[model samples]
Target: MAEKKIDKARRNFLFGAVRRFKNEDPDQIEASTAECVDLIKQANALYVDGDFEAARDAYRDCLKSDQNDADIRYRLGVCQYRVGKYRQAKLEFERTLRIDRTYQDAFLYLGLTLVRLGKPEKAPALWSQYFNIKAVVVQRELNLQIGLLENGESDPADTIAEAVEKAIEQAGSAVG
Candidate 1:
């Protein structure tokens, strides 16, 4: 009889919780999402305008609402970097990459942050990965240009080979 009473109470509590959840206003949820989007947009504008401190604050506000947003974390890191908070920026960037490993920009910034933190030796491997991805993108663009040229399109001022060579030079300079 005690077991039956406990089970009944447990089921009643769950049903009550579900009923309360289902009773939430859809408009409230939509408003919350829209507010988050607006905050992110405002933060991005502030960052672009070079107001790093303000942008960082706005990003923090957004993060309060959505802790798992990797892009927000990355932008916050960038703001921290601009403000000379290298150690904090490093942590944020690392967190961003942890949340989204395919975030190439975070990797590049994290490496740059390491360099600024006086750990230059650790940056090369990160930069190498960044440059490899860059090279692949450049190669794709070069192939498109070559294809256009082969089909009798006007030759661009700089050939695909020249672009590839320049990318290699820049990569070398970045590493060395």
Candidate 2:
């Protein structure tokens, strides 16, 4: 008799929780959206100003609000890369990719981070993944920039065509 009473109470509690979850406060969601916009604006300003540490902190704050956002995770990874936190950057990029496998930039950045960590062999796979997701024209432009050393893996927004080139060269030598 006592066991049946406990089961009934547990079922009722679960149903109540589900009901509350399905009826979230709309105004609260609106306020969170506005706050997220403000945080993004602040983080973007800090990033554009070349204050990566501050931008990283701001991005982290944004993550607290939306932990599953792949773009925020990618931005945090870029900021970590800029600050020479290669391992942290690598982890963030990995997390970003896990959240959104089709995020081409995360693949590129993860490849670059691998090269920076002296794990060049891992980069080719990631670069290949990036190429698979990227457009041919964009790939050509990025390769051109990297060949010229203009954008060659310099920043998060930049290209990692050099890593791809190096990986190809390494493969050629191994085959030879």
Candidate 3:
């Protein structure tokens, strides 16, 4: 009888939590949106002013309000990366990617973090993803470097044109 009662209570609690989450008020979302926008602006201003520490704090506050925001998470990761918190930066970037799989910048930065960690082999997929999203010339240059590192090739720029051609083909496939 005791075990049955305990099981019933657990089920009830779980149901209640799910109900609350499912019925979360629209007003909460609106309020959080306003707060997040303001916080993002402040954080950006701080970053532009070279106040990275303050920017980090502002980004953290934004995350507290809307933990699921991929852009905010990505900005926070960049700030953390600039501050030399590589592991925390990686975690934030990973979380951003989890929220939005198509976030190219997070993948690029995550690849950078992996490179810093001496895991060069793990960077090609992320670099490829970034390339597929945007055709920035700088990113193209970086991709060749990462590809060279992964393949243990000493000449990074040897096949630059060929790699860019392939990357463009891949990017076309992505849009299709």
- Which stretches in model 1 have alpha-carbon errors above 4 Å? 1-32, 131-176
- What's the best-to-worst order under lDDT? 3, 2, 1
lDDT of each: 0.65, 0.65, 0.67
Model 1 residue 134 lDDT?
Answer: 44
lDDT per residue as tens, model 1, 1-176: 11121233344455665657789533342113334777777888898787999999999998886666788899899899879898999999999988988777676667667756765456546655553444555434434444554465624333433453355446542311
Top candidate, metric TM-score = 3
Specify the poorest-scoring 10-residue window by lDDT in model 2: 1-10
Using lDDT as the yardstick, the better of models 1 and 3 is 3
- TM per candidate comes to 0.58, 0.61, 0.67
- What clash pairs does model 2 have? none
What is the lDDT for 173 in model 1? 26
lDDT of 3 by residue, 1-176 (tens): 11111233344455665658788643332222553565678787887676878999998997776677787788788788778787998999999999999887787778777765656567677777774435555466666676576678824332443454345445542311
Ten residues in a row with the worst lDDT in model 1?
A: 1-10
lDDT of 1 at 124: 47
